[model samples]
Target: MHSVVKLADAKRSPKWTDSQTESGSDRRFSQHASDLVLRQVAKAYRIDGKRLPVLEDINLTVEPGQFVTIVGASGCGKSTLLRLISGLERDFDGEILVSGRNVTGPSLNRGLIFQDHRLFPWLNVEDNVALAFESRRIDPADKRRIIQEHLKLVGLTGFEKAFPYQLSGGMAQRAAIARALVNEPEILLLDEPLGAVDALTRLYLQNELQRIWTQKGVTMIMVTHDIDEALFLGDRVVVLQSRPGRVRRIIDVDLPHPRDREDRQIARLKKEILADLAGEH
Candidate 1:
């Protein structure tokens, strides 16, 4: 995570707040649920025996089943922030609570998807997804059923026997998503999971992800560099400035589901975001 985020520069909240933010129109449900809170969280990377700050103090609240996107220039620590929330980094300074419990380490409750599919080349699609449930003590039949259902959930219903190499980039990533979700995580963390795919495939997966998230009711926080992607998929898009990345602005995408990227409103925000990123702020 040698990203551009420098922890020393992240602004922190003076006091940790416990009150949940009111359910915005973006939240699907009437009541609050699936909240992922980060309070003054900071992270630093160790490279060459030296400490480099990646993310400074960060505070955020993500409502249940909400699709939140974080966008920044490369190295602005967007991915590092996700890692901290995912408990991939223990050396950071901060408090992260998911649904009211402190996150000590990785849990089956938090599903993480990275840029690389990270599938086992030796395993088939069904087996790769089933691996997520390995530590659990569920029955074999139950596991198989879960795997089958999730494959369908990710639109990979008929590709059970396909291996990672056998599938296209988009399909493999979808399988990877099935694996992350097979465990039924409460929160989904996506770190540019579609970054490596071709443009057409990336666009297709983006829409598929929105449908999946909406149908499943799992909280989603995606980190990406594509401003259009962010505006297209996020309920609220958070913009970060580079060099010790900090939350510059949070925009509410009030449009309804199945958004059209070509919509005039989205196009307007896209230009504004691009302008802000270009130092026209």
Candidate 2:
């Protein structure tokens, strides 16, 4: 049997420290300081010569190295909002800023993860991860070292030769995550990244994600439907209301890392969020 990569044992205390920051990379999250600001942001789509707004007046801030989760009903434009922050949806209105600079387009400082793994089938794991650095002008040796470090960070070091088909759902997602982080982005934007995995694997990968977030201290803004997952992982949870999506509320988790699933405070907050959502209907 091929050696399966175990997600639980995959993460170690990250050895890639602040001193190793790539040249010209701002390394904004090193001291826990990647302030993300969104001001009066609005997005719309046109159909049949009519404008249909998807998001409206979205204003929020994510502190550096903070884990911020967004939860809302379908059509609330959660994913669309993330797209704006990623600079993929340039058609939107208003301002998006990271570390006080306007986000005109995507840069190496921002990494994005979609729900699907989206790895190239023909590319082996290492090559797939390597794709993130195609435009970088670094030494080949440095690139190889960065890739290896990220693979270990995500727990796929030994499976570098494996193809996407050979990896399980969780492992494929891990590879995708590695690809995103290899650039050492100051912020990672996640769009329901764990939604496709099985229940058990989802739980395991959530732990792995927490470890990676802690070790790398990268600013993260993730969209998830699971209230429990949001509260567990997020320092703050932003809820949006649909029909021209808008910020309904922002709830603070106020819990420490590696939180217990059964904590009473989490349960209470969950009820509050559920009630808040139910009221929107």
Candidate 3:
């Protein structure tokens, strides 16, 4: 099961500060404070006294609210890169800095959503999302409010009582997204979160993701095999080369959000990316 580490300082109050005007109708989640920077990051594993490299010399920077997507052929270590960023794997070369501080382990500041929903089969939507706050010191009322706000953010407002089995693939993914966002993470790392859904539902979720990203202003980095999805949602796309994954090229979408899928530039870039992927061995 996915979980967030508790806030380091137990005495510090919860960051979800709520204030009300006379009408008592305004509520907001705090914006993230840190941007992500990775410098010369490389990882390797040992197999029977032999070293196997996965990622090599990865250097990238994500602005505080920018959306960056990564694309590559299989075995290029896209998911491995996300694991390193999330601090799930610490044994690697180079440094990953967030706000000039090293990322040593998992914290609530970064949230990761896998391709699978990973929701507990027996837990309802509400309970699954609430799992993120299990180790938090937040008040019960505030936690409840945050859960509801994130559920509404992902269009799962009425399905709070539903279990994973009760939802369609798209709906389950939405619930996964909501659970990932419940902690108001500084950066949301998605490892092919939309890969399991059907075509039409994937398109709809793409729009929904953009809307949520616009509203929340959380920095996002996603890895996907879909070139169209990468172009439609990314401000920049980083392509990787296999055989000890390295940055092959970084293409700037250079287009605004809510981009049209039919844009000529997208079509042109798709051809280029396809050729690049096809040429890779």
Candidate 4:
């Protein structure tokens, strides 16, 4: 069960401040829609009395309202990096800051979605989404409105009572997305959210994800193996190298939204990213 401090309440909650005083930079806050800064971050695991490094020197700053996509080969720690930012793993070295404050643990301000739609098999769509609001203290009317709005945003408006198994793969994923959004998180971290669906449905959901991003104006960071998907959806693509994953390059997608898959720039960038991935072998 996930917990949340309502987006509006979080803004005013004294427990979480409105402003963050970074080491040397000017103060930043959630009103700016949340900015994520990671510096000198590294992670390792100990096995058989030996230390095994998984990621090294991962440094990035995602600005408010940006869609940053991360692509790399397996074992490159793309998902591990996402976990660090999500505050699910805190034994890492260095720092992860959200709006200038250290990310010590998971908060309602950051929502996470995985490849599998981890919906409760016993719960219907509305009930599963309603779980996000379990700890929120808002009025019932407001809670209902939030759930309805997010469902509509994900185009699952009429399937409010449908069970997860009853819906198509795409629809189930949409419900998962709605659950993530119902909290009104300022930053959404997705770990291959569309990986389980068929290719055609994956393409369609990319469009849906773009639309939702536009509607909510939240910062999004996603990890994927699909080069075309990365180019199609990201404002910027960060490529990583394997064997102690490290950043290789970050490519800017200057094209406007509803981007053309056949655009010359997209094609060129795709080739470049493919070459980069191949080089990691």
Candidate 5:
């Protein structure tokens, strides 16, 4: 299920403030949608010689370039699921496919963003973003150009020279986003990328993300604790239950871009979803 919303009216919960933000965000939301398929994926962890299943027989699909959010109680394998798909951890059962290709290892085609902005403190914004392209033997000039373009795409143009230490939480996260996009990964895996930010900054970053997704058309799978965030950003929001995590429900947010905060249907849906998550009748 999927719903389009008015992009503007969507709730912005930024985690930071006081930074010159982007001139524009890249959103490649073509009318033509695509999807990623996860088939019967299961995971287990080894602890003290015991095998503990973290996830079991899970299956889900995210339309190509669609923004999908997974929310559930902690220890439900949200991050573990992301790690498997990102190819960080391959010790799992079931097939993880992106665009019909089985994900065996981390490839330049897939990008992963973590809760912490993994920017190198020594490197400036531009360099950090450009580092993503270092695997290939490219001319310095080309790499530099790619970095500049991606920084601008993530709205961090002038801060190219700013070190991670000099940036606010939101700014650093934006820089991380810029780096993630530098390689032009077909799918992005976010493990609570915005969880560490403040309220205001998180709001702004949310809007920035929408703009980017709408422009880039990259398939995104985000794990979030905030139900509202999931509702606002995902075409389909998947709620999971604990104890061998399973999908409790999948709801399609049927709104249009430039979403309205006060839209009656949106508010009602949010309330209903919240209630359902709360185990309310």
Candidate 6:
């Protein structure tokens, strides 16, 4: 089981010595300090003047460069969990630590990709990616290079000038991925990023995402509904129970990367996972 840190003691948490860096007048933590820890995480919402709990006693830890996938039924607070981790939702009870530092709000260190591409309709591929660097003081030439490199990273080398309307669904999503990665965030949060694509495209993108994760070695926590996709890409699959979403079980995929879809172990795990989701344990 992963260790859980108490929220009250978050202020006394030890700082990661090697993860600190001086950037201008501010102290910035390196993207390399990507490990995430959640302790006693819980959330609820007010519905018709009554409180409805969504996630309860959620505790999880994701090591740096680890690919962890979350699978659960709809309305299981899967997306809400991602929102909390990404620092988009702060009104919750928990301590979310990234490299020992508490996550108070959205930071450039964490990147979020949604189910839709969410790219600007007017911006071309390269420009859409360049939007990520707009707030920084990077040189124009360096920024352009970074954009082009990320585009190439997602197999959009020749489509730099193409607009979102001109690209296929898969291509647009690839551009979104490129945009999310341009900053080289330590953790990439994906919420059903491939759910909007066709089956063949989704399969192809799964392999591509795995390749990207292997190449970048960035920590990834993806919320997916497809058990096969989750098993195929994740180092560990986190199965969550519905209603008040909670960790039901965490299964380790000991197989090496570039895993075979027809592997006997994978088949067995899939069967086991399906049974678990069906409450058949």
Tell me, by lDDT, which candidate is best.
2
Per-residue alpha-carbon lDDT of candidate 2 for residues 47-128, written as tens digits (9 for 90 to 100)? 9999999999999988667789999988899999999999997898999989899998888789999999999999999999
Cα lDDT for residue 106, candidate 5: 93
Q: In angstroms, give how far residue 225 of model 1 lies from its true place.
A: 0.5
Model 1, 1-281: lDDT tens per residue? Answer: 11111110110111112222442432332232377888988877789998887787788888666789999889899998888788887677878999889998888888899999999999999989988988889999999998888899888999999889999999999999999887778789999998999999999999889777766667789999999899998988999887677788889888766688799999999988898889923
Clashing pairs in 4: none
Taken over the whole model, the C-alpha lDDT of each candidate is: 0.81, 0.86, 0.84, 0.85, 0.78, 0.85
Cα lDDT for residue 54, candidate 3:
97
Clashing pairs in 1: 3-75, 4-75, 5-54, 5-75, 5-77, 6-54, 7-55, 7-56, 10-56
1 versus 2: better lDDT goes to: 2
The TM-score of predicted model 4 comes to: 0.88
Q: What is the lDDT of residue 142 in candidate 4?
A: 92
How do the residues 73-128 of candidate 3 rate in per-residue lDDT, one tens digit apiece?
88899999999999999999999998689999998989999999899999999999
TM-score to true structure, per model:
0.86, 0.89, 0.88, 0.88, 0.85, 0.88
Off by more than 4 A, model 2: 1-28, 31-33
lDDT: which is higher, 1 or 6?
Answer: 6
The TM-score that candidate 1 achieves is 0.86
Which pairs clash (backbone N, Cα, C closer than 3 Å) in model 6? none
Candidate 5 lDDT over residue span 1-281, tens digit each: 03223322222112111111331222333222234788999998889999888998888987556688898877778998899988999889999887688989998778899999999998888778878977888888988888888888887889988999999999899899888887778888899999999998898898889888766667788999887788778877888776677777888776755466677876887787677667722
Residue 9, candidate 4: C-alpha displacement in angstroms: 29
